[model samples]
Target: MTSTPSANLFKPLEAGDPAVVGGYRLAAVLGTGGMGKVYLTYTPGGRPIALKVIRPEFSEDLEFRRRFQREVQSAQRVQGLYTAPVIDSDTEGSQPWLATAYVPGPSLGHAVAQHGALPLRSVLLLSVGVAEALHVIHGAGIVHRDLKPANVLLASDGPRVIDFGIARAADTTALTGTGVSVGTPSFMAPEQASAGTVSPATDIFALGQIAAYAAIGSPAYGEGSSHAVLYRIVHEDPDLSRVPAELLPLVTRCLTRDPAGRPSLTEIIELCHEISPVPLRQGEDWLPQAVAGSITERLRLPEPAKTPPPLPTVAPTPTQYAPQQPQTPPPTQFSPQHPAPGGVNPYAPTGFSQAAAPTQSAPGIPGPVPPPGHPMQPTPPPGYATRPTPQPGYHTPPPVVHAPYTGPQQPKKKRTGLIVAASVVGAIVVLGVIGSLLPDGSGKDDESKSPSGGGSSASSTGGGSGDGEASGTDAGKKRPDPKPASYQGIDVTENYLVMLAGDPPRPEEGDPIYGGGDLSYYVDSMFGDTWIGTDNGKFILLNNSQKGSLETCRTETRYTEKITLDQLSAGTEFCVLSDAGHIAVATYKGKGGAKESTYVTFDLTVWRNAEEAKEED
Candidate 1:
């Protein structure tokens, strides 16, 4: 049976209707939930922002309002490169509302539904970004009680964390009322399912589920009724077999049933870095881009159309056979005349014998005897009582009788057909086995291609091949290529630290700093603050707190040349008019960038080389 469509699904709205609350005017409705509506609104300066207002019933509760106010305050303190920052809020207003920087992108749920699960690289990036966000939030003594795919946004830059309404401060006395369960069942941690106090580890558990979903296109625990899902969360192990072998361990750690057993967000960040090392080339950023024409030309192929042939028809064959005739009786009494003594009658010659004789007596023998030539009838004996005679031309076959005898008989043609069918199937199976054992020889082009140029020999190396050998030529004795000489020395410039690495002749002794290519890399501390950047237009601000390391960075918005950062210095923020009649800002801090100055930006193509030497545990 079809399900009833949800009332919130694609509801219409009239133009010019005031969808706003307080000072923020809602340009469009972004989403809705059990609590309230989220609108895509604008700030006074026309900067796009997401505005969330409480439901009218919840707004009247002073305690809820106070709790929400504290949540907003705590959310505002979250500092990272992967979280949206709270731009403004008015808890004291008649209709309380909170506005955050609008991150234009699809929700993780929407993205996964539309495009299937993300690639391994993208999943890695998402996990790292979300974990970093959680780390920042937890460091500020806040626990995001509701961490699900719906609250995660996949912006062009990377994944951004959102939804802080139900978040709780670690030291606050405020708690959700009894019987009010929060969080999506599929993404909740064991403690959260049991309605126990949530911690940063809870968010980590939720992130693990989200990662599993992103990797396998479904939740690891599977989907069903909410109660069933919650029970599985508490009592069952997730199906992590579909997860990439390289990431299974990390995901398993995050999904440990015991909250205390789960890895910390700090550990998650390190794992992400290890699994998905940042590439060296800036052009290899995760952002989607159209392939070059030449590349597409090389990969494109035309499909051939197939058509079925007409079926043949067969005609039915006719057979010729003679019908049997009944024997006639003698003229005197119109009855079967007994053979002289033991001699058989002339009509019952050869195959027809006494066994074929009818049991009935002489026909038409009565007081009014019928003449001969009339149809034959049975007559009773004088001493015995007479019975009514049966009508002529009506005959009944005698009951079948069997004699016990043992002898072999030829099998039927139908049985032969079945044997032929079974033999054909067996032949097909044997041929298939033989084919699999033999070498595939349609052509070299039809053969499987390996990452290495050599054919798939037993000793062949590299990926995309069937051979079970290492990719490197000197697999047994090879060491990693050394970090470039250019990257060895450090150069500090205004707002940057440049490390230039030169090419090496062979492998390096220790872990290489930058082996992929010759590029200027920098890590420097200015006024007791560390910053890393490339000579190219990329930078990462590193902030160390008692909790962990936080990284933030910013890049210009495409088409408008607006420099968007994690946080902008007050006097440095300004707007410029674009040539295309668009208003562009000189610099604007990203949610994470504005809150904390930790940023990371670099060429990601170098990762391909690093991945070659990496081993899965």
Candidate 2:
């Protein structure tokens, strides 16, 4: 019986499936992949785990078994934040199996297929995570050989690179001798495509392809027959025209034809960090809102079913029992006087049939039934604790304990506190008069407070209200409303305009595109309609009758849907809340001639909550 929102992701166990492996009971089938079938299981302490059992055909081969064992060992040593490390494995057994930490999220391939390409910021964050995973894998003297979208799982916080060492185990298998390519064709490096030596650089090339695939909802190298795609990978340049401009240079560098020319993992991480300076934490919000919600749904896996109760030793004998009343008995109400042992009902419906039961006492047995409410009762068992008899229609009440009470004590006499209060008040008044007559002991005027100069207070505090005061604002006046970061007359066209990084307002571009992909908004011209939306942020059109101010944008709730240009007017204003927690109000300025071009313009003013900005600092 499935009970969770994500229970549909798992399939019921088949008749032939092993109930237990390595002492862990299998709960459900996660899915089958190229390597093996994955099952949802739990450790002895009930921590959820993903158990991968190798296919029988692969486990039968002596060479495959040897390689699998070695790879499992190396994979066990790999401990990285972005990787699902091997928890347990048994390569010597008839059915080789390994368990890893179960990350609850859809695969990157599924996410992209369901929700187009990720925003530029999400892609950059993904690159950093995958690069970090590769760094750890390579440091353990293992080449991932296959690094593609399907191998990466999108968790709520970040990307988790799984199946790290499985590909290397299958690298020298007999299948390769049959002219079968070891890795995915579209994501393969030039060297790997041509059957050349594979190294850490090969994984780097694949990482670049994955990044490009994530930026655009397709492979870097266009899809085709295996041979055709492989040929293009080895001989032709990738179709990077649709890749986000900020990620273009980095992708190009990693996809370098020559293995030696490809940048190292450290360099790749550095490139991503340069593009997005903030360090990506393990549980940071990096995925698009829609994708993040999908991950959250996957995390709601059903709780494991309770262990089945042991079969009864002898069937119950009822005076007027009916034999044709179905093999299972009706559900019974359990009470404190007669509880189910191990929390399992012996006669409850179960998957296993009664015919398979052995004729002997089983560990799990329902406790003795309670006697009907009557004056006479049967004797209790030796070890059973005795309980008070419950009434015919009511449960026995719990025992109540009473506190000891002493005799009533005499009331204390009420104090005349008015006299005491008057005395204290008179003393405070006398001290105040004395303090007024005291001299300016320091001999320095109150105006000479800070030695650094007249603007010392302003200089010490730096930005915000300090800057306002330093700019000749009256001290008695309230600190002026915070000035928002603004950018004007931004032309948003086919290419995404990263509102977070635009000052003079230009398309996402830079020298080698090192630090640009901070996406905030984009213009989509699909189905002959121009729409304004975001892939990494939230957007809500407030109204078309009047323009919205910064305060309105900050307070308004934003939705994750696009607004058509027709719904917008010269006076229309909407709110954009980026994934990075920066909120901005974008007022529609104008658009290119409807027939001449497909572009819209907006004047955007960005603001970060003072608390958020201070935390970043």
Q: Which candidate number has the best lDDT?
A: 2
* lDDT, residue 505, candidate 2: 42
For all candidates in order, the CA lDDT equals 0.51, 0.67
Candidate 2 TM-score, C-alpha based:
0.50
* Deviation (Å) of 514 in candidate 1: 54
Tens digits of per-residue lDDT, candidate 2, 284-375, equal 46777788887677666656656644544443333212222433323322112222333333232211112222232345543233243422
Candidate 1 has its poorest 10 consecutive residues by lDDT at: 545-554
Q: Model 1 TM-score?
A: 0.43
Instruction: Write down the TM-score of every candidate.
Output: 0.43, 0.50
TM-score winner among the candidates?
A: 2
lDDT of 2 at 554: 60
Q: Put down candidate 1 lDDT per residue, 1-617, tens digits, no spaces.
A: 12232233223335623433443334556677655567665543445567676555555555556677788777778767888888766665555666777775667787777667777788887887888788787787777777888898877667889875454421111122222334578998987764445777888898899999988889999999876887788778999989988789789999999888998878887887777756412123553332122122222221111221222222212210112244553332111332221233222111111322322334642222232223333232222244455455334323349977778787755788889999999999999998876756766533434334355532333433322335444377433322211111122222322222112212122201111112222222222322221211222322222111111111322222112332333223332221111121122222223322333232211111222211111
Error of 1 at 211 (Å): 0.9
Give the clash total for candidate 2.
Answer: 0
